[model samples]
Target: MNSAVTSRTLARTDSVRPFKAGAYGFVLLGIGHLALSAAAATATQTSERRAVDTVMRESTFALLGLERTVLDVFNGMSIAMAFFSITCGLLILAAVRHAPALVQRRTAFGWCALAVSLAVLVVSVLLLPPPPIVVLTVTSCAFGLSLRRATTVSAHAAEAA
Candidate 1:
């Protein structure tokens, strides 16, 4: 009898096309985040140094090695945030694939991960310059909304019977 109910639940879940699409979307977003992050880590350091050089060219503290200090500090933070973003994306992808029940119950986890990614990107706009704002924002918001809808459907299904 329990097995029958479980089968019924799975059948109902199968009809949720959005959930499947959202899972795929999360996977793609995760891959994009990882790839872009790697690109930034490898190629952008010189650009970042150039920007710092431009900004500090007129400042007196150029004599105190302030430009190099700023570059080091901000570069370290940017690298750390990039790694964190990639890890969060990967976690979302993994959870959607291997742990749907956990995803449903702890929907906040997914939301928080997306939110953090958005927040970091938004900050990067000012500090790092020309980060992929639109892609990250849209993908994060869409994935978060889809995950929320999935959990809601699951809840409604449970309450209906």
Candidate 2:
């Protein structure tokens, strides 16, 4: 899941599409990301990862006057990323509950989501594997389709009004 979408895709607009997409899709993805990270952290390491961990532990680097190993930095970064994703997801969900008057108007909410998801999709495709790439692709399409439908509905409303 893209942190940018979890953090920035939701706007204060009155759009249920935002709520449904963010709550159903993005929030679930965030939780899944955190769960997967926790699982990986606890699962027995593969030989490749174990070897890397050994080498990483052997080397020490100074950061802020404290000595840290590569493994320390790597683990810290991974945990932080997972924490950030779940945090954003929970926050968005909270917003959905507390803010009930979010189904009357529309804004660029989906555009923001689509943009960030697309960018993340590209990066995932280039650097990561298929799982993340597929997630991003699905998210991008959701946002785009939601945005299109929202616009079409609102446009008809404008005509009727």
Candidate 3:
């Protein structure tokens, strides 16, 4: 019932809420990235199969060009995205374990990382297969949320100090 105890409790609660939100947001972003990669992989396989069929029917090697090269790059990128997503997820899990301690000091770094990731997501969506717009959108939103939460938590922690 002491005022000091109540203030401490409130401060702790407020500090934790943003960290929790940011951690979950990062996790969701990772999951969405993984899903996008999986979908891209499937689409790439299908397209490759179709290309083989067309080549067989036409009996020509004339289908090689910039478009084909771009598709191949996109295919490779899907694998890269899968790895990135898993890595981000693990990092977020670690942050969750450490909570305020880990996230509090790295708020700026986290924001920068999220911004870069969002930019990559946008570029990938533009250059890659088309059906996973929802995945990209969700991932973007989650990263934005994570950045917002990190900023809020960092500001609150500074004020408390």
Against the unseen true structure, what C-alpha lDDT does each candidate score? Answer: 0.54, 0.64, 0.55
Clashing pairs in 2: none
Candidate 2 overall Cα lDDT vs. reference?
Answer: 0.64
Write one digit per residue (lDDT tens) for candidate 2, span 1-161: 65555455554333555545643555555666678878888999999988988999999999789999998998887667656656655665565466533323335444555677788779878987676677667777766655544534456578789
Model 3, position 77, has a per-residue lDDT of: 65
Checking candidate 1 for backbone clashes, the offending pairs are: none
**What order do candidates take by lDDT, descending?**
2, 3, 1
Write down the TM-score of every candidate: 0.51, 0.66, 0.48
Off by over 4 Å in 2: 1-15, 94-106, 152-161
| After superposition, candidate 1 runs with Cα above 4 Å error | 1-51, 54-68, 104-106, 124-131, 153-161
lDDT of 3 by residue, 1-161 (tens): 65554443334323334544444544565566667667754674676678865564554332455334444554556567656755765676576576654444446645654575577568758875543445455545654554444435546677889
Q: Can you give the lDDT of residue 39 in candidate 3?
A: 75
The predictions' CA RMSDs to the true structure, in order, are: 8.4, 10.6, 7.5
**In model 1, what is the error at residue 72, expressed in angstroms?**
1.5
